[model samples]
Target: MKKSTLTQDNIWMKEPEEHDFPAAQDYLELLLVPDAAKKIVEDLKKAPTIIKKSKDILRASRLPLLPETNIHVKENLKKVQKNKKLSPILLMRGQNDLIIADGYHRLCCSYYLTEDMDVPCRLV
Candidate 1:
């Protein structure tokens, strides 16, 4: 698909979608025990949203950015072209670096728009 030009503004919903918590829990379960993962997901549900720059998030998380050609990233970029509001990211603080838990694709997609973009997220 041809990509759409994206800006940092109005690209995200004020809060994450309800399904995000479950997805986060699923990912966290891999790194942590199921009980621990569940608790983190619970905490994230109640956590207030905060903004972090795309660059800062990637640096803090120490995660590789998926290329724009990634299927998920490409699909999200298409959503942005249609002005669809994407759910905010869900994150957590791991033992050392930050953990994305969910929304990795969203972060990478936003980075392509501009690393200076402020991404809405709830970090636990």
Candidate 2:
């Protein structure tokens, strides 16, 4: 599959200068079904795995990432490429958006590596 044009430089990839934990929390509350939200949080508290899914599917979702965060992702990607296990991305099934609660940078990095990459994620 062709790679998505979406990247750190993309307009949709813009993020607040400061990490907005509260806003993210509020958005989750607003977007998720109560039980589903709770289940994800609970799952986060437990073990997470690197489940591979198509990068094209994720690109269609149109979730954004922080450019600054991408720097870290690049560094981590090097380690991942070297056989290190990075944490699973936290995703939420929202009514209108495929919300990425965490690990947008990792997703972007994986996209950079290969468009058809079976990117790893922890879906809720």
What's the CA RMSD for each of the models?
A: 2.6, 9.4
Question: TM-scores for all candidates?
Answer: 0.93, 0.54
* Candidate 1 steric clashes: 0
lDDT of each residue in 1-124, candidate 2, tens digit only: 1235322222122222223333344556776776766566666444344455537536556855434346676776665545544444666666676777766676676656555555545555
Candidate 1 Cα misplacement greater than 4 A, ranges: 1-9
Candidate whose TM-score is highest: 1
What is the RMSD, in Å, between candidate 1 and the native fold over all Cα? Answer: 2.6
Best by lDDT: 1
For model 1, which pairs clash? none
Q: Lowest-lDDT window of 10 residues in candidate 2?
A: 9-18
Model 1 lDDT per residue over 47-113, tens place: 9999999999999999999989999999998888788877889999978899998999999988887
